[model samples]
Target: MRFMTTSDKPENATGGESAADDTAEVTGIAAQDWDRASADPQYRAAVVDLLGALAYGELAAFERLAEDAKLAPTLVDKAELAKMAAAEFHHFERLAGRLTEIGEEPTRAMEPFVDALDGFHKQTAPSDWLEGLVKAYVGDSIASDFYREVAAHLDSDTRGLVLAVLDDTGHAGFAVEKVRAAIDEDPRVGGRLALWARRLMGEALSQSQRVVADRDALSTMLVGGVADGFDLAEVGRMFSRITEAHTKRMAALGLAA
Candidate 1:
């Protein structure tokens, strides 16, 4: 599977036209320059795939968090997880709306990603509250980093929307605090949780590979030699950045990366 990275330089146009004009022609959406960029056939197809993947991801996150809330040791923690789950659902709704606005059926768009994401959750189901907390923080951070990298390739409006939905919802800080406090209470947990974190990363990557392999349009948009495209080196750098961010998040939880 090939990955694409975000270039530090500005995105170039496909032809002589600006990225905005290209998007508007392809996507048929009348939002902004970024939205206009969605009109490009490849770009529009990739955007739909992106939105669908994101919508399903958020929906699955909501369900998983809600389940995790049941394992919370305290009423307060349970409520907090529940709140986070609700927030995920809200993001899902926004992405679904965007899909509809683009003349795509939201359910159809999300359908292709369902199995891969579901398999990920099944493989990495948390056994305890602490494990759940770590997954919430570390797993979500990795996914968010990836989406942010992809957003860099998008037009301004579309980029803004992607960034907006991927924003941290305070769950990261909460998970970090809780996991750190737990480790402070029992040092042995640090080792176990660190191993668990590794397992989560592996499972997520496995599923991600499946998604990328299945979604040709999305993959082409990222790494194809089209105008404003990303090269393999850029993709390597993007993964490196994601790894660095994941390591930092693990450190924040007082766990080894």
Candidate 2:
């Protein structure tokens, strides 16, 4: 997947007039700009927390992908992962820059999320190249789905940035192709990957809940204290959607969900 580099500039979050209008309509923000929406300190805090979590996620993804590359069986695979790692780092830069633009220090913003995310990586460390690929695809997608659910309720600018940064980093298709090929070569691999994916699913969901629970602003935003936040019913439905997507991705990878 193509991605921005250091020379590339960030998108103008303010320029997506039609898209922003649609999001604003859905979220009941009525086209409120970030300036107006951020007037509320709680909402601003939520945005900061959201950006912080996402920035750190991208940075971690970059690191993980680079390390996973060392396990590649071929030079082509290594190069491919390197490219993807660069893309993830590019995404991190965008998020970090956005945090700075919004008057928050990037490192400080990401600090609160470091322990949770790092602990997740430690607990769910993959044993090999295939497992690493599975982790990147399954684990990252779950996080993206959760963020997308929350993004639906955010103001236009923040929503746009969140969605943009969550773009696929060539991992989904790459993982599916590599994993299915492996399973085809030895069908027993399917069972192993299936189990690995299930473990990733549980851990990812747990971390997601933990992160939100630890952040009052984020939790409040998700549970309806902020702009058009989800009610309890919708929160349940959101997880259902995320799980459904996970099942589909696992099928694509030739693994049971």
Clashing pairs in 2: none
- Measured with C-alpha atoms, the lDDT of residue 242 in candidate 2 is 86
lDDT tens digits by residue: candidate 1, 124-209:
99999999988988878998999877876665676788899998888988988888888999999999999999999988888887
Report the lDDT tens digits of candidate 2 across residue range 173-232: 898899989999999999998999999888877887788779988777665433334456
Cα lDDT computed for each candidate against the true fold: 0.79, 0.79
Residue 223, candidate 2: alpha-carbon lDDT: 56
Off by over 4 Å in 2: 1-27, 226-230
What C-alpha lDDT, on a 0 to 100 scale, does residue 154 get in candidate 1?
Answer: 69
* Candidate 1 off by > 4 Å: 1-7, 11-35, 227-230
Model 1 pairs whose backbones collide:
23-36, 23-37, 23-39, 24-36, 26-39, 26-40, 27-38, 27-39
